[model samples]
Each structure stands twice: as structure tokens, then as C-alpha cells.
Target: MTSSARPRRRRRDRDRGTYSVETAVLAPVMISLLLLMVAFGRVVDAEGAVDAAARAAARAASLERDATSAESEAQSAAVRSLETEGVTCRTSSVVIDTGGYALDVGVDATVTATISCATPLSDIGLPGLPGSKTLTASWTSPIDTYRGRQ
Candidate 1:
């Protein structure tokens, strides 16, 4: 019994630090994967926020009575929506298509709002990733058929 126990003790001693070695080898890989997941999640979140901003801009523009006011309101609405959603863009642009405002009163007309946002990813600490990604979203809302437009 003493002889058998001696060999088992020696084997256990040899394997004592193996767990630490394995952990050291795998920790970075695990952390890298975690970082990647977080980066992707941020990008998806930014896309959703951009889409919401576009929708808000289009809706605001569609509610206006004239093309000039529609364009101004769309820009303001997009900025406000982005701020409310906590999305910070390196550079942003809002484009409004107010041609629908010039259409005949009885015609089915729609206003389009396009929002482009350059979302910063440099803070994510992932190597080999781009510093920024540009995401664009567009939304169209119907103009009031009976409302006067110019």
C-alpha cells in the first residue's frame, strides 16, 4: 500500500501547476473572444439606433405642411433622436427628400429621410479592427393627402 501511494503522490505533484499553465494559455483567447462579442454587439446597437433616427426624421418631415419646413424639421428630429438613443457618431449626415411635398394633394406622396452615422469602434480595444464603421438607414413616411404643400 505504501509503494502504490508513493507513485500516486509523485504523479499528483507533477500535475499540480498544470491547471495554472492551461489557464495562462487560454485566458487571452477567451478575453479576445469576449471583446469581439462586445464589439459586434455595439455595432448592432448602433445600427438599430440609426434606423430609429431615420424613422423619427421621416415621421417628423411627413407631418410638416411644406417642403422647406419638412427639410428643417427632419434634420432636427434626426439629431434629437440620436441624442436620445445615446449614440455618438464621429460624423453624421441627414438627407431629406421632400419631393412628395410638391405632389398633387390627392396623390399618394411620401417623404424620405436618410441618416448616415460613422460609429467609432476604436475604444473597443480590438486590434486589426477598423476605427469606425459607417451605418446608414432610410425611412419613408406618407405625406398627408389632404394637406397643402409647396
Candidate 2:
């Protein structure tokens, strides 16, 4: 047998199972990376939902003329915003400040809304992560000086 033929036979045997071995080593890494990305994406989406909820609720409360109506409107707006964005929270709270209603219309007054949302990360069950994360956001809207006051 020629030396070249012997070398060629050795090379073929060495490479025979390389692809299968590489796949076995790389498959888990790729899958883990994919799972991590999904978890991160979900958290980012929840962050956006919380921001939108705070803004919507604050705006709704600012538009109301009375504290009673403002609180109700803010809570409703926050829930609607979260539901529309497909973000599920284990606990949700909304606090509305309608101090602007008592101030003179010409005075600078602002309505503030604070929202707290606790979301469960256990639903995804990613490794080395906590069970839940809480997100809180506050937004303020200025009352228009020219607008009628209750």
C-alpha cells in the first residue's frame, strides 16, 4: 500500500464522527442561549408594559376634575394598559394624588400616579433566577391652568 493511501485512510477515520461530536457539544449551548434570550425579552416586555401603564394612568387621572373619579380612572387605565400589552402581574397597585384639585387653577399643580407591578419569573422557570420581580414607575401630569376646576 502507498504511503499516501495510508494517510488518506487515517484522515477519513479521524474525521468520521467529528460532526456528530461537535453537534453534541454545541446543541446544549445553543439551546441555553436561546432560553436566556427569551427570558430577557420577556423581562424587557414587562418593563415596557409597566412604563406604559404608569403613563396612561397618570394622564387619565390628570384629566379628571375630582379625586374620587381620578383614583377610579387611574386604576382602570392601569389595568387596561397591562392587559392590552399582555403582561401578567401577581400583584398590582396604583396610587393617585389629586392634590391639584384643591389648588387654585392659576397655581402650578400636578397630578402624580405611582404604580407597582410584581411579575412572576417562575412561569418561565429559567435557572439561577428569582421567582418574581417587582417593577415600579411614577408619572406626573400638569394640570392646565386654563381648564375648569371642580
Please tell me which predicted candidate would have the highest TM-score against the true structure.
1
Clashing pairs in 2: none
Q: Write the per-residue lDDT of candidate 2 for residues 88-127, one digit (tens) a residue.
A: 9999899988999888778888889998999888866567
Runs in model 2 deviating more than 4 A are 148-150
Query: Residue 99 of candidate 1: its Cα lDDT?
Result: 90
**C-alpha lDDT score of every prediction, in listed order:** 0.96, 0.88
Worst 10 contiguous positions by lDDT, candidate 2? 121-130
TM-score of 2: 0.88
How well does candidate 2 score on lDDT at residue 99?
90
TM-score, one value per model: 0.95, 0.88
Candidate 2 lDDT for residue 117: 91
For model 1, the local distance difference test gives 0.96
Clashing pairs in 1: none
User: Which residue runs does candidate 1 get wrong by more than 4 Å?
Assistant: none
